[model samples]
Target chain A: MDRTIAIDVSHLSKTYDSYRAVDDLSFQVYAGEIFGLLGPNGAGKSTTLRTLITLLHPTSGAATVMGYDTVRDADKVRTLIGYVPQERAIDRFLTGREHLQLLGALYHLTKEEAAKRIAKLLTLVELEAHADRPAKTYSGGMKRKLDIACGLLPDPKVLFLDEPTLGLDVQSRLRIWEYVRMLKARGMTIVMTTNYLDEADQLCDRLAIIDGGKIKTLGSPVELKIALGGDIVSLTLKETDRIHSLESELKDRPAIKAVRATTKGLDIRVESPEKALPTILESANRLGCNIEFIQYNRPRLDDVFIAHTGRAITESIPESETA
Target chain B: MAHYWQEISALTMRWVRRLSREKFSMLFTLVQPMLFWLIFFGNLFQRAADTQVMQAPNYISFLAAGVVVMTVLNNGLAGGVDLLFDKENGFLERLMSTPIHRTSVILSRFIFVMGITSMQVLVILGVAYLFGVQPATGILGVAMIVLIGMMFGIGLTAISMAMAFSVKSHGDFFSVLGFLSLPMIFLSSALVPLTAMPGWMSFLAQFNPMTWAIDAVRPLILSGWTEALPHVGMVVLVMLVFDALCLYGGAKAFRRAMG
Candidate 1:
């Protein structure tokens, strides 16, 4: 309800015949925040993005972006938001500059304003060197950058990026992250949907872990990890025979929250790795268990996702389905 | 309303810029088919005047009208293919997400087809004149020819666009195009007149809308307004109904696609 909220989706649902895509989903993204809908395919991230951008009408409940109702005031909402879908929408025949000019005209921008914004976008995406080349001639990463530039031509209030970096190499993907950071720095509210957990971890200010068409949990990356109430303990062992017995002993201890044996050693989750490690070291020494290495790391978003969704995010759905 | 037109214009320009770069599409869709009819068919059927195969001043004049109608058919039906590619490739999804009126998407397509059809018709007419076939209806008859071709073009283009939106893949769309295009061309007197055909074929050609178009356009090229007027009036009425149905159906199909 705050005026600073850029998008407000409440109990929104979309169904295709008997199969529901998004169910009873509610969230608010404040202005200048980079919010992510983190989920595997069929978890309703893209569906939510589409509904908010006014590309698809929701079957039930209410949604708004910057105070404009998505359904009733869709046209006004259109002017206020920009969207880049999973697939690149560039016309292969046209040069990158031409594509931007055309989209600028669609947004009713003046010639001078369009030129200025286009130059700025090209420079921001680092595509100015390739701006005049036919889009088909550009690399996959460049084509995607052009798509993002097209979406940004209107200088929209809310930019929705649905898997914008999908299918790109790491370098190209990072370049997109740079563009997004620049946009956010300029005070633009960005709503992104991605299945890549690391991407959500690195780029999103806040994320919602969705599965089965429902929001399982929502919070900032640090907040979600902290709320998981555990630190990761990974131990590389010199011997494997006593791995199960050692894990069980560690699990029985109040300090060790959970323990599992990894290929190289033992991976554990505990209330405090520092407090749990000394006892585990003593137990290993007493049991004649040989250990090669031991380490500790904070809980990641993937751990948070698994804790809330009851399955690892990567294993929730096959890769093909998510793409 | 003004913003609506601006949106349509902007979208239409997108098609125009793309088409301008494709030499093959420009040539194949408009020229090759027309030239084949004029040279091979016209020369082969030159002495058919003795057989009464065509009811016109000469084979050239008779074939000229059919060629014009055929151009409209080819350009209109294949025009939606670009749209289908755009849809499958995600360009259409991007366009729909924009702020413009959605109808502008289809209208720009209509304008693009009509623009290409008009140019092709003129080129065909120019070639026919060079070959010594002059219209008795003169410049006015030329205008009438364009009018008939465009009206027919509008309906077929709308149907093609509807199918583009409805079909799942380009493979399925090509199958539909292959089935309807040849039959429509052959059954409707694009290569032969109704009277010259067997009784059964002519009977079916009566319901074939292309038959109506050629029947109306042939007189303007050869005889005069006096003979062409009644057929023009009837063909225009049929074309209007056909266009209304196709445009409405195409809009509904497009809406379903958006959903």
Candidate 2:
């Protein structure tokens, strides 16, 4: 299927004083697609998003949103996009309904239009019961939901969410994911940045694995994993025979692609774990090696990230958030 | 143009709502100056203040104009606190990301501060009336005083907002505010006539925009419009130059910060 580009960034770079935050980067976001910039903290994901939103000017190159230049036609670009920043931006004193009303007014929505949109958004975000209460009294989840509702106020052509669920609880994170999917269902193009492995894999239709101010790799989650192109079989052998002989035997097997010795045991790469596991066991049996433990699984997005960046993304994920 | 008004009014109403919600602060913003300056301090020096040098019926009458302009100075100098808080809290960034006219952010703040300054001015006038003081130029003169207070406020508020955008944090902004407010009040004619102050102090007072504002307002309360109009005209000219410089600095700082 042919898709029109909603956002095009060409060789964009942003430098702050002596440090380059984003170096020579280029990508395109298609219409009606949920695109994500997957990277660790200070990996330049937020800088790229800010440049596209016209908040920060790119030091070199340029970006366009809906064909409007982000720099030359910022006001025109601003009208077509909704941005929810990583930081919490809700006014503590204003009630949920009042926030939406104020944003509606700023968006130049008439009184009747603001009222209609406010009511619908309040209901949609499930904050109707607490709509009149001050935002200071809200939970973190409620606050994030309120921010999302605010972003949806303009019914924007593109929505930019910067770490939308960075500090949210599991329940709130799931709820946000649901809302993001619903927005996509309504044909709204979304650009989000996240460091979570599951968030990138589960939420993004296509994502760019950004690292050190550049695109390390970019593709659908499935395509990236398939590009790794094999299942991994990990084995821990009991102390009964020569591990080197077992490794050599597995290396000669046609089903096994490669074999490398790990501290615990052997890590063997193969086309199909189901077909290769029996052949490896037979070779180990011939060598009189007792298999204490064995585990086999398909390559995950983490593996794909490691393949491109040579570092596990799990290292950057917080302990509690690593599912 | 319609969009400008709509956005400014909407943003200004946000300030109004927030201010109204903080009942304690709202009450104190009006009553604090009145309690400390107009009633206690003014009456404390009622007997000590020389009427001939003041050229007024009494101390309270002369102090009324000082108190009104002083309130404008205090409120105006601190006008950017709310905007600074918005910046710190990240709401300013959100507003900037929207399609609204960016000038509306600064303009709305000006409108809100001036609105509150007008209310405070009226409250001080009403209280001064109870102390047996009245504007010599009557109702029109009273309106003129509020107008002057607002004019003086614009320059001070512009300076305050420039600091808000320029400073790295609220702590630094407060430090600068403390450094500025007391010296400005003391160096002006807010507390005493220029003749009563030392020669050097009076020389410095002449340079204070606050002094010009107070000098402009003193005649409206103690003398009539015939004596007051010239001072008003002079202060208006001074404030215009003052506001232009402040607003230019403010716009520069705003551009750098927003960028």
lDDT, model 2: 0.88
| lDDT tens per residue, model 1, A1-323 | 45488889999998877778889999999999999999988898888888998888998988999999999999999999888988888799999999888787778787899899999999877899999988989999989988998889888999999998889999999989988998999999999999899999999999999887899999999999998898987788888878887888788788887676766778778888778889889989887888888787888887788778766666746422221
Candidate 2 has which clashing residue pairs, if any? none
| Candidate 2 Cα outliers beyond 4 Å, as residue runs | A228-297, A306-323
Give the TM-score of chain A, superposed on the true chain A, for all candidates in the order listed. Answer: 0.87, 0.85
DockQ of each: 0.66, 0.62
lDDT of 2 by residue, B1-259 (tens): 9999999988999999998899998889878555478898889989998999888888888888888988998899899998898888778878988898879999999999999999999999999999998888989888988888988899889889989988888999999999998888899998899989999999999999999889888998888888989999999999889888988888998888777
Per-model TM-score versus the true fold: 0.90, 0.87
Model 1: which residue pairs collide?
A: none
Candidate 1 displacement at residue B91 in angstroms = 1.8
lDDT of 1 by residue, B1-259 (tens): 8778778888899888887788897667567576788877887888855436676667887888888898888888887998999998889878887888878889999998898889889989999999898988999889989989999999999999999999989999999988888878788877777877889888888898898999888888878999999999999999999889988998898888786
Top DockQ hit: 1
